[model samples]
Target: MAPQSNKQWTVNGTSGFDALKFNENAPIPKLGDKDVLVRFHGASLNYRDLIIPKGQYPFPQRDGVVPASDGSGTVEEVGGQVTRFKKGDEVVTLFNQGHLGGSLNPTINETGVGGVIDGTLRQYGKFDEQGLVKKPKNLNFLEASTLSCAGLTAWNGLYGLESRALKQGDWVLTQGTGGVSIFALQFAKSAGATVIATTSSAAKAETLKKLGADHVINYKEDTNWGETARKLTPDQLGVHHVLEVGGPTTMAQSLKAIKIDGVISIIGFLGGVKGDQPTFLDCLTNICTVRGVLVGSRLMFEDMNRAVEANNIKPVVDEKVFSLEEVREAYEYMWAQKHFGKLCIRID
Candidate 1:
């Protein structure tokens, strides 16, 4: 392959709420020691991508920073000291280059892509070799792009160092069919766990069932579906784990649906971040552990890839794919909350 020119979107400012501007004449990054230059082919979108440009929480906007967090590509060049990967290796991005594992640190935020630094939505990116992971053999580039963020979030929440800790025959409550929730459902079922899912419509419920959910609850039809889900369980003691995607509103209900000493992995904020929720006393009374999750480390990404390769688990990608020119439109689509699973942008 020949040397490629870079085309990218950058945040010029934040006042208009439309902060992103594309620059086709952007300079290609030079490779440094221990660096690998990758020609990225695809990028996957997340809910965070929609909120980042509006001067919101999670991470503030930086002028001239690239916007998307997840990317996948083939290694094009390597510096003299690079050894982990050579040319032609298909690889995926890791959101945080530091904070390898075991404990949280400031480095995660400082070095985070699409947050505090330039991200991976560009046509080309030169990353340190240490920050990339080998793509799962069973997945194509578009499927592998999603693992950097949403996939790892589910994996880290379920199997991390301080994971809520699930096992075979355990019961899990998954909130929706978004990227993280869908991945959690697949992983739980793969581990021989019973999965109960909540969705807004009968059609999505049916789809969830086809994906192996044992029971699907329509939260729209039944406002008290949390209690209903608990009653459907074996002992009516509630699910052993709750993958809490809706923040406080669903969390209040998640509290009602949890077993004693159960765990809730709080991974998203779709339902509102602050509002009525389980009281501290309620958590104490039930011995329920609430664990907040960030996307996992390189180590967790590698472990999840091994499982994906061994089990042949395919990520659920939305049918629609946008090109690099439609980056803003892609974010708008994700913001509409209509996509069943992950969405991708083709950079080739």
Candidate 2:
């Protein structure tokens, strides 16, 4: 068999991302007993990708590392033992490829896509069949690309609330208009929950309302946004679920905006690294449950796709398409927080 050729963006030893033009000179990514080879169509960026080069989340064995954990494409080949998918099926990679579900394993945590292992940022990437889910038929490649990491985090954070289920007419609060927060709004609305979405831009607040947010708060205008969130919910009981993406800096306010025993999903660190520690005393007083969420597993990814398919949920994609060569600029745009939604790189 002839070897395949592919273009990949690689960060060599924490320097910078550059085009690494290479022939797939190695074996055609021979599937493990249960793996599949996907030809990537699109990939979306997360804040973690921007922090990699700065050593915030350092990869010890960094050579040939492609930095993106979210992508969707078609399966070109599959292992002999693979049964979930066949050739030419559309699929996306699960964020934590090795960890199937439940409590995180140290070994599984150590080897994650785009971090310890090479990720889906390349034109061709391989993963265990268990880590791949059929893309929702309603979504195109760009929309499907946003789901692996951000979508799962929002789903797990909101729906995974153990204390109380998010019923219709209940209110859910999201901190910003980033990928996860935007997904939170879409999902909350689809689940018949009202969304009180907050953003720094009034323009974005309007956009949020269009996306079915019941109320939008300009956090920049209202410094005490927590009180505003409480006012939006019924009888000052506060929101049922707070999609708490702003860690530490906004944790106290998130606590204030939740109903007694409401769930707060702490998902991101965008509000300055190493802010003041959360006051657990206040959290206890409010009887709020703070759930620390990493991106979810393969099972959650499949379940989320089901929900997306059933609800016909469309991801709010801030399209800034880049070729493989423009990888650095893509990262820069995401870091600048200029994009309203996911920043995608087309790899075909």
- Top candidate on TM-score is 1
Candidate 1's error at 278, in angstroms? 2.4
Instruction: Kindly list the per-residue Cα lDDT of model 1 for residues 39-83, writing each as its tens digit.
Output: 899899888877677665565446677887899999988999999
The lDDT for every candidate, in the order shown, is 0.85, 0.81
Candidate 2 deviant stretches above 4 angstroms: 1-3, 15-28, 58-63
Write candidate 2's Cα lDDT for 1-348 as tens digits. 322766676655655444332333333466786889999998988888887766666333365677788889999888889999998999988877776877667777766677777776678888888888899999999889989889999998877655576778888999888999999888888888988988998788888888888888888898889988998777878998998888888887888788987898889878866757667788889888888888877777777889899999999888568766677888878788889887888877
Best by lDDT: 1
| Residue 227 shift from truth in candidate 1, angstroms | 1.2
* For every candidate, C-alpha RMSD to the true structure in Å: 1.5, 2.3
